[model samples]
Target: MRFAISIPQFYADGEFDPAAFRAYFARAEALGCYESAWAQEMTLSASPQLSPLEAMTYAAACTSTLRLGCVVFVTTLHSPVHLAKSLATLDQLSGGRLEVGVGTGGPQRPFAAFGVDRSRYLARFTEGLALTKALWTRDSVTFDGEFWQLKDARMEPKPAQKPYPRLWFGASGDGALRRAVRLGDGFFGAGSSSTAAFAAQVSVVREALAAAGRPAAEFPIAKRIYIGIDSDAARARQRVNAALAGIYGRRVPAIEEAAVAGTVADCVAAARAVAAAGAELILFTPLYEVPEHAGQIAAEIIPQLG
Candidate 1:
């Protein structure tokens, strides 16, 4: 399975330091240990954070080889036409190394703050995805949808990649899984999901692929996992839990339940389980306090998988 790292845009102190984050990505690429680097999107959070798009743009500029991705952009917050254009621009600028992942906006505050009708988020997400795809592949597009209307409008300087950059969906429910199979190139399982829960969602996605007459191999699967590795398993777990409490203002149940933390052997075992469950890519989000722990994972745990 491919391995990637996620950089938190906000720190425990509720401040963001873009330059420091960019330096981390540079170091990750230099280590020759990551396949991609992704950013998270949290629209109306209680913390200070850099926007996902801005973070991605910065990472794209700093790294030449590591694929740049958005873990998932909230689709219901912006016009698809505008978002498509912005993403296409990034794709062009990044030399075709952009992977776009999107989800229906969550957290009522963001939707309410942005003046988006929360009731129609799902419909808007579907319509926006359809429009974005058309804009990328077709020379021109005209569509009349419930939320948007376009008249022979065309987006230029199409993404460097053919059709468009790879599109992934971050989904949590059965309906979202079905929609992802129908519309996306891949699905990103929720970060907090259990192994059993991930297995169920993967089954749903595969079934949708089958019903659509699409080969399962054509669609990749990705999962975000919190990982902490140290010589002492108990210490590792404590560190991860501490980080979670700092970031989320609550305690994570345990490494076994909410994260992958332990000695190197234990972490490898956890990753192996996820791979066995059919996850093609595993994106690691190191606990907040131990962001640098990712480098240790790159050096110690990832090599064992091969």
Candidate 2:
């Protein structure tokens, strides 16, 4: 089973320790077991989080072999041209060690803040994705769409990887999962989703791929698992719930329930269940004590899971 870890992004005011951040990546890279590191995007949140792109850029500078990615950049809220250029530049900077995940977030996002039409967000997402792909693959692109229009535009040098980087889709519903099969390179189950739910989602994805005549091996499946490990069971659960609250900016019991918190054995069992659920790549996300979690995952947890 391939493993991935969350990049530390939580920082309040002057709390971002540059040396510690670099050291974290250094240690993670030395572990040599992780497939990649990913950051979450929360452009409008009470949480004091670093922007995913900036966090990823800093991480790329710190590590050599480790790949970098962001999960589910809400494409509807972005200007496709600018977003495409930035990602293409990052891919070049990172020597093509970049994975791009996109999603049309729920309808309740503050669309007005980003000048997105709430009623037409789905169209915006698909069109923007298509435009981004065109910009990445085409030397000169001419496109006429409802939201974006480009006439004979050139995105320089292209990405180091042919046909752009892998596009992973964060989706929940059946229609959206099918859409992911149609457009995205893979499916990424959310951290908020329970293992059973992820299993169900995996079934849907497999059916869609079968219907489309796509090989399951060509489409990778991954999930972010919120995990808290400690000898003190109650303390672990409490810390996990509090961290989830901070991440979501609200008390969400269901999301909190999705987290795995307890002893090392408990975590190993939980991770095994997730693997059984069909996650080829399991991204362990600890909302607190980033470095500690990475160490434990690499040393204590992953070894047992295997």
Candidate 3:
């Protein structure tokens, strides 16, 4: 299984320390424990955050080989053309070490703020995905769709990865899982989802791929795990809950249960269950005391995952 980590981005006010951020990447890259580093996009939220693209770009500049990505960029709320170009440029800047993730983010997003009609958002998401792919892979494109129209559009500097970067679709529902099988290069399970839920989703994706006669080997399955490591189980759980509340702006019980917080053995068992659930790639996202958790994971947790 492949392992990864989350990039630090939840900085508020004048709290961002550039030197510390650079040091984090340097240490993470030198460890060679993680195959890639990922960020999350929160365009509109109470959480003070940095944009995923900018964070990934900065992290890319700090490391020579570590891949950088956002797990899911609520593409439905963005301009496909602009998003595509930005990602393409980032891919070039990072020397092809870019992973592209997209998701509808469900109907709960503030669509009206982005001038989007909630009823037709699924259509918009599908069209936007198509348009983005066209922009990335084609020299010239003429397209007419329900939401977008373009004639002989040209996007310079195609992504460094041939065709495009690995297209990962973040999904939860069975229908969405099927859609990922139909359109995405891989499926990414959200960190908020419990291990049981991810197992069910993976079953749906696998069945859909089998029905479509697609090779499962070509489609990677990954999940982001919210982790808290400490010998004091109760304290670790409390810290994880508090950090999650800060990140999400409230206490979400389901997500709290989803987070793995306890002793090292407790974390190992939880992560093993995820791998058995079909997550070939597991991204460890330490909420608080990131560097300390990273050290624990590298020294005490990861070696035992096997």
TM-scores for the candidates: 0.91, 0.99, 0.99
> How many backbone overlaps does candidate 3 show?
0
Residue ranges of candidate 3 with Cα displaced over 4 Å: none
Per-residue accuracy of model 1 over 167-266 as CA lDDT, tens digit each: 8999878988998888889998767777778889999998899999998888999988887777888999888777666555566574347588898899
- Tens-place lDDT digits, model 3, residues 1-306: 899999998889999999999999888987778899999998887788899999999999999999999999999999999999999999999999999899998999999999999999999999999999999999998999998899999999999999899999999999999999999999999999999999999999999999999999999999999999888999999999999998888999999999999999999999999999999999999999887777788778788876
Which candidate, 1 or 2, has the higher lDDT?
2
Error of 3 at 249 (Å): 1.4
Candidate 1 residues lying further than 4 Å off, grouped into runs, are 12-19, 106-110, 249-256, 289-291
Candidate 2 at 209: error in angstroms?
A: 0.4
Q: Candidate 2 vs. truth: CA RMSD? A: 0.7
Question: Which residue pairs does candidate 1 place in steric collision?
Answer: none
